[model samples]
Target: MLEDKKDGWKAAIALAPAMIFLVVFMFFPLVNTTIMSFMEGFQFRANAGIFAISHRYQGIGFQEYINVLRDPIFLTALKNTMVMVVISVPISVILGLLVSVCLNNIKRLQNIFQTIFFLPYVTNTIALGMVFKVMFSTNNGLINLIVETFGGDKIAWLTDATTKGYWSALFVITCYTVWSGLAFKILVFLSGLQSIDKQYYEAARIDGASRARVFWKITVPLLSPMIAYITITSFIGAFKAYESVIAVFGRGSYIFGPAGDTNMWITVVGYVYKLLPSLMTPGNLSKASAGSVILLLIILAFTGIQLYVSKKRVHY
Candidate 1:
């Protein structure tokens, strides 16, 4: 009994550091942020040119939520986030699945191709965003240079919303997102593909099943579990896809747009960044906190719906 107690304590001691780290770096900060969202204004502010501190909780009503909903910027951010979720998730998953299957069929250089596909995932986002910004620049960008070299006019990739140039920027952003996101999905699909019984495919082939028919009838159903996982994760990732965009695009001038032409393309994280600066100001702090809470709830609702739907669809 004493030995068992000592072993348990040793195990707990092994876990203690991680537990402490989580509490300090994650849980405590999360709790503080949540509580801060409920409180009014900043923790410290200047009143009549004198420094002051207020700890009072405020803005606890429908009005807080109404205020958030009423803001056009917030609405645009929400719409943009949803659009990103819609666009990026499907494309990335499909592309990842395709790449995974292709890799599965390849006998040699499989690792090389898979590594190439995954390279972008490990590359620094800030560096990649900077590189992409230059490549997609309106003038003298490599993309425009290529187009012009082929006797095409030098097209504006950014800062021109007219004639769908704004969409060009969006496409550029989405392309990189898809590129960066594919690695994880590919890994997932590969794992799923590997786990599937080889005898199943052999059995289908002996039954005169074509490749497409076999894939649809055999591979896809078995891949559902990983597909479901990718779906949920991709949905969540859409909310976070703004990091690269923000790095490439300047802050808040075009702030998710080519001058109000393409409104509401910002992700939820971008919206939070918009409010983050208000943390130092007591007046705006509460409202910002409210915004934070709303964003959290929105994300929670989206993920919950996805999980419930996927659970219903997943066949054991």
Candidate 2:
């Protein structure tokens, strides 16, 4: 009993630093944000004489949520984030899986190929976004050049924020998002593929299974765990999509295609950031906090659904 108690104490002591960090950084902030989300009007007053501080808010309810929901920009951010999550996650996963399978099949220069594909994962997002922006720019862009060569009209890609330009911009952003996300997905899938036992493949081959059959049956079943992990992570990453927007659209006047007449794109995170500068506006901070809370609930819902589905679909 004494030895076990000593071991337990040592383990707890080892974990103390991490526990402190999580309490200070994660749990406290999460609780604070949740409370702040409901503030109608918040103010802090400090009294030095008695060393006392006081804070007050008018009331607490769903009003902040309603305010954020009523804002057209917040609705637009929701729409954009949903589109991003729906489109980018699947495309990135499928493409990464396909590329990983191809790399697994080949023996020659496989490492080199993987290194090349993973280069974009480590590369600077802002720099890569700039390159993609240049490729699709309205004037003298490579895409426009190709269109001209094919006797097609030069489409405005990144310039105009009108409906037409919005589609073009969305296409570029989606393409960049899909491409940028592939490297890490591929690396993960490749690692999963390598860990799969060769005996399974050999048995399938002995059973005269076709490549397609082996892939669908043996490979996919074994990789379901990794696939689920990647899909969940990708959805979360896509929802918090401010960096990609900033990278591709340039934080200039045309950013996120502004949820307005320009019909530009902006994620919920970007909208929250746009709110920060005007925090002086009554209830604005609460609205931003409400948006964050909504985002948190959405992510939790997605993860829950994925986990539930994965219980049936994923093979260990």
Candidate 3:
């Protein structure tokens, strides 16, 4: 009993630093944001003596939430984010799985191929974005160069001149999101594939199972756990997408394709980021906090649904 108790104390001591860090950075901020979200007629004042800004609400109600939901920019962000989630997640997962399987089958240069596919993940997002920007540049970009070589007109992919509403810019953004995320997903699936016992594959092959049948029955079922995990994380990440848009369209106002509203491609987190610089406006902090809270709830709800559904489908 004494030894066990002493070991328990040591374990607690080992975990203390992480627990404290989480409380200070994650837990406290979440709690504070939740409180701020409810503030109505919120006021912010700076006290030089304390070197801190103080804030309070005159009447706490649903005003912050109401304001966020009523904003057209927020609505547009919500739409783009939803489209991103719906489109990007599955495509990334499927492509990653396919590439992983192909890489696993190759007997030669497999490590080199795996590294090539994973290079984007290890590279900086801003750098990759710049490379992609050059590739898609309107005047002399690689994409335009190819198009012109084939007698097609040059198209401005990121600017407001694109005639396809938000589709052109959105296409560029979605492709980046999918391509950038592929490396991690491919790595995960490859790890899962390697962990599976060879006996299963051998048995399937001896039984003369077709490639399609073997894949769906053995590989897919074995990988369902990884797939579920990736899907959940991808959905959450897609909802919080901000930097990719910034990377592709830049900080320029009215750059979201044909509609040309700066807010057109603004994501939920992007909206929150834009509002955070202004502390002088009444309830401004509350509005940003409310937006953050809504995004949290959206992520939680989607995660919950995925978890529930995965219980039925996920093999492990």
Instruction: Give stretches of model 3 more than 4 Å off.
Output: 47-54, 161-165, 252-259, 278-283
CA lDDT scores, all candidates in order: 0.74, 0.83, 0.84
Q: What is the lDDT, from 0 to 100, of the residue 35 in candidate 1?
A: 66
Q: Mind sharing the TM-score for model 2?
A: 0.90
- Expressed as tens digits, the lDDT of each residue in 149-237 for candidate 3 is 99999887876543463777888888999999999999999999999999999999999999999999999999999999998999999
User: Which is the winner by lDDT between candidate 1 and candidate 2?
Assistant: 2
What value does the lDDT take at residue 90 in candidate 3?
Answer: 88
Q: After superposition, how far is residue 173 of candidate 2 from its true place, in Å?
A: 0.9
Candidate 1 lDDT over 96-144, as tens digits, reads: 9989999998989999998998888788887777788888887878998
TM-score of each: 0.84, 0.90, 0.92
State residue 245's C-alpha deviation in candidate 2, in Å: 1.2
Error of 1 at 68 (Å): 1.9
**Stretch of 10 with least lDDT, candidate 1:** 45-54
